[model samples]
Target: MPEEFGPVGRGEAIQALSREVLIRRSLDISPSGFITIISIIQGVALGLLAQNTFPKPTVLGGIQSVTLLLVFVSVFYYYLTMSVLLRWAPSFLDCFLPFVIASLEIPPAFFLGNAVAWNAWLAGFWFLTMGGLMITTKWSPVSHFGNVRKAHRLLHDLLRELRYTAGIGGFMVAFCALCAHLIPWQRQGWGIVGAGTVLAMVAMIVARTELRASQIHALYGVNRPPFN
Candidate 1:
């Protein structure tokens, strides 16, 4: 059975073990902790607004306030997740690249959300920026203790992952742009854009899976014919 499975490469084995540890540690924390925390914060804010404890603002002002809040929350979440992932999976920086990319969207989303007042153009821009960020972060340098060599390896792996992720992002940008243009400017348009966004997200996930499989094949030398 072991032979049938082929020789286990040390790097592959380490990656597998590290991932298992990450999973186990993640499970130990309350699965709903993040959701619960967010919910509580939102509920408190809503209650304050309802009781007139907070001064009412114009619609644009409200949007800007919410966008700023989201930006801060997203940054905090990214820091927390990265800290945990780095501690758990020290070898592969690729695992955290997606999170970093996603986190970057918060800033731009905040800007566009405030500017467009939920306009499709802003929404589409948010998705496009998010996708682009994901692709960009994959190629960016990763540093720990300023070790140049280690950082380079991490960056290389990140770029490999990004190359796969960019395909998904490209599709999303196209779809979002289409929806932004096609949908009428109204609440219903926003709803349609939201649906399209979800579809794009699903596609991104599929792309990631396909890319990982390709990477594994390449790693195993399956793509290269043996010397005759």
Candidate 2:
């Protein structure tokens, strides 16, 4: 290992890691907890909405049911990714992301309850919000490390990954917007929205996994691949 990347000493390394952990815990625990609460609310509300809205099978029932199911999965995926990010990386956006997710639950529920015809718009906005955040923000798990260069390198890598995520998000937003207008609110339209949501979810999953890998590299400092 290079001198710059070498750990200062076992005791100092432990102290640095421990302090970072403590600081993160203090800063992030509440945000993560709040996200979890919101996730529960979203899941329950969406479940009830699905139950009421899609009670019987019809000509387009299969498509609508599958689309709703995909939306539910997307919500669950968002909760998992956001909770992990809140727990691992501190950002000013933390204060806002949970509220955004909470607010989004309203649209679908309202649309279902009142029979509004804006599903495409709703889903398009979802992709745009999530992607925009992923592209715009910077988050890092390691702030204090015995090896300062390692910490900086990890932060750099994480930021680079965010750039890649942003590119994906940009694509998703454009595709979703185009689809939203083209089909608007047909059975096929919901399916299109579901496809865009899946892409957004995949991008989020990739970003989350990158974060986990960076956290692991920060802690373990293994020569092997971070994923392995």
Tens-place lDDT digits, model 2, residues 1-228: 755755566457544457778876766675566656666766776775666566654433344444445555555654554444334444556656655655555455434321123344354445555554454344533443344556445545554554455455545545554664575465355444544554565556455555655564555654434335
Q: Among these predicted structures, which one has the highest TM-score?
A: 2
Q: In model 2, where do residues sit more than 4 Å from their true spots?
A: 1-28, 56-93, 109-119, 122-136, 139-190, 193-228
Model 2 TM-score (2 dp) = 0.51
lDDT of 1 by residue, 1-228 (tens): 554656767667534547777777665543244334444544544444334322654554354444434434443443343332232222234334433444433333322322323333334434544554464455444442144454345434534454444455444445544554565364344433443443444354434434443443444355522221
| Model 1 global lDDT (CA atoms, 0 to 1) | 0.42
Best by lDDT: 2
Model 1 bad stretches (over 4 Å): 1-78, 84-194, 199-228
